[model samples]
Target: MAGREIVLAEKIDLHLCWEGKQLYLKPIPTFLLHHDFFTHAICTAAAPPGSTTASSDLYASACGFLKSYTKLIRHESDLAIAQEKNLIPASVTWNQWCDFSADIVLNTTGMILSQRYDYGELRLTRLNLLYEMHACEPFHWGDHRYKFLLDTISHEWLLFTFVYFTVVLTAMQAVLATQYGAGSVGIQRAAFGCGVFVLVVAGGSCVLMGVFVWLRAYVLFFSETWIGRQQYRIYYLDRILEALVLSE
Candidate 1:
């Protein structure tokens, strides 16, 4: 809580690195470090080595805060402001700050001030942050051209195919009309019935295609959410282990 204590906490050599989209926290290995009496007391109060009994819920809540916090931080200036407000540490860059803050808080207080903040306020904050991040990034049309082309074809292909078939059917009807000379009533009736059957088949095919697309999208969404939850659980366990090692 005091400035001296905060400074001491910062003195611990901790670093964050990214491997793909996953973050890893590196600390001085346990065998190479010497701990003082005060450090031992702090670590004991935080959590026991190899156990997260007291810190489990706190760590989970802190992780949610860290993720939302990380998403909001997009620039050096934003990071500076967060540091000024003591929301994050001054020692790290924006990219490295979230894990550091989470590590420090979970090891010390196991509490976040934002936990008391309103949900609506947090949602609005995240929305504003997202807009700012999007606005700051440069958009390149060339990078998205392939995606645009694919989407266009996906949305219009059914209509285009239907139009092609309709044109062919119309040409066939015109030929029948000319050949029959408008006097063969039975042939005309048979031709009309065949055309109706073709229309029915085409409409059924379109309906089936629509249902298939909807199901595919639903499955993809469900799979992504399940995978994301699993990844987050792994990340949380890793962070807890890293904190335990550092405390040692």
Candidate 2:
């Protein structure tokens, strides 16, 4: 009974692990990567290979992952962790290595592809969009307010045109009210109402726009503590953005 309970608990843990990471996508992530579970799994004895070939032959399925890592791996720590010196005891067999690599590459890709628009794809799309807008990495290394303001202000001619049009319209309405209002009260009231409506709409829009900019700016620069600073970043400001993607 005790043995059965222990087995059940482990199976539950394993299920939880896979379930947690069944969706999120990120670079070099794995289910048990860097966890004590990983250490325990590696410490277990690996079954012997079918052939008499050297252990290197076991890595046939994992060669693709190795090639990709060799070419695109950005972090030296990843390489260091996979070294033979660090993988003592039972170490990782070819099966384990393949599983690890699959979890990082294939599983992540599959999850992203299977996800709905508002889920994984949405977050990844957001991340990519932000990546294009960013001048540098880490996503929070610089002040982006100037860039946004300058980018918008670059279209100042349009705003100037709108303002000029509104001013002229208001002036014309004033003329209509003063010159023709007594002759036709309806025309005068219509002109005055039109001018007031336009002003109110335009002014309200400007105020709302300004408020939106101010709020976004505040959010961008928020976070007093070091941990708070990571809230917006560290996986693209989405829930579970860091949940499993931050692993490995």
Candidate 3:
């Protein structure tokens, strides 16, 4: 099994863009069709129960997609039965029907995003979620958010605490927090550099310290739970020159 060559049967290209809070997926991908998580995501519009913000029209469309896609896929431990009597399409194999179902569901993506926007969600599609996990040095191992949490009781307390922390050469505690960022690394480098140059400053340290503390908290929150607890290790795939969803 180790040496076996696993051909990538599903190849896709995905482009993610952002305008304000809404993450616009240029064209919805079809590879997510087979996954149970994706099915649930679309069906629920990723909305909460009794939430009025969720668009019913979108929810209905999502549900409509599930109705057809989930029709033939039933519970586990069921004996396979011939569908000749049901006149099931010859092209619809077990793994075969996924492409079609994905197409049907993708048509309703606009509605899905509409419902999602109400909740302030849809930050990133499942495909890129895995890369954001800093399992090694940054998010979890370095314990960046530990003392930062304690200093959050009040701003005045934080100001004095930060002053003392910086003088003590304990700045490394915040290295994880300081280096972390959201946008392009180039932008982060500039922002981080500003904090470093003024690290031991007179009054400006307070401002930079505040920014670092905020960053640690941000990384902590996002690593554990993405915006609205929406996605984790998600993936999808699309065609070559096609939309792709990875780890859907």
Candidate 4:
């Protein structure tokens, strides 16, 4: 019989090796480059025999990729809003919604393209998205407050975006530091920059986490508002109820 081939599917597990120990985690999607996955796949499929290459081909592919990322982000953004509003389950598998979100960072376009070029394309693109998400996700909280304890949280797409970037950057920086001398100026600078990036990321995470915690705790323990005769309803809720009551 001909030798059997093992084909990796869109989903795979991430394994971490430490001190000869292996840790296998949940299933994650392979990197599809969202917008560029098909384009790149086609290009690679039809790639000219190392003979005909054009800058336009690369640029066109990149533009397509960006469009794809935007589309995916928009889709995820909507889903996150829905989830926050308690329209979806908090434990819903990310992969169940978007394969792109479920993909493991290491398997993404950045890794595949890294060796072929001077730099990795997917990773950089991801970082750009991540930076935007990190800076913007917190503001969404103000817009998505629930009427009560069971109300959904909004802007979760932003949270996952941050998580993926954090994981990727941390791994990349650690590898660079370990493989290259940690004391070397280049490594030190890279590490420092990575540190700052991570600090900002961590700060964002903390803010979001804190907001959720506060909202949940406040809803559970405190009366809604003190401005009304009801005396027990939240202030915002009382106002809303009053408006409804008067509208009749």
lDDT of 4 by residue, 1-248 (tens): 22222222222111111111222111222333344764565445333333343434444343333333333334656557435644345554456656534443212332222122222122322332343346422221222234322233445776787788778677767776574556578767776787788779789877977787685556433432322335545666879999999999
User: Which scores better on lDDT, 1 or 2?
Assistant: 1
Q: Candidate 3, residues 163-182: lDDT per residue as tens digits? A: 77565444433443564534
Off by over 4 Å in 2: 1-144, 149-171, 174-182, 223-248
lDDT of 1 at 200: 91
Order by lDDT, highest first: 1, 4, 3, 2
Per-residue lDDT over 50-149 for candidate 1, one digit per residue giving the tens place of the 0 to 100 score: 4535444433333334444544465678678556645454566655565544554454443332332224122222332343346421122223422322
CA lDDT of each prediction against the hidden true structure: 0.47, 0.41, 0.41, 0.43
Worst lDDT window (10 residues) for model 3?
6-15
**Model 3 pairs whose backbones collide:** 12-238, 234-247, 235-246, 235-247, 235-248, 236-245, 236-246, 236-247, 237-245, 238-244
C-alpha TM-scores of all predictions: 0.33, 0.32, 0.20, 0.26
Instruction: Please give the distance, in angstroms, between residue 53's alpha carbon in candidate 1 and its true position after superposition.
Output: 50
Q: Which ten residues in a row are the worst by lDDT in model 4?
A: 11-20
Cα RMSDs, all models: 19.0, 18.4, 21.7, 21.9
Which candidate's TM-score is highest? Answer: 1
lDDT of 2 by residue, 1-248 (tens): 11111111121112111111131212232433564653355313222334333223223212322334433333444344334223212344545555555555642232212112212112222342364346222232223434542232334765785788678686766677574655887777767777787778778867876786675445444422444667657646675656567773
Ranking by TM-score: 1, 2, 4, 3
Off by over 4 Å in 4: 1-152, 177-183, 208-228, 231-248
- Whichever of 1 and 3 has more TM-score, that candidate is 1
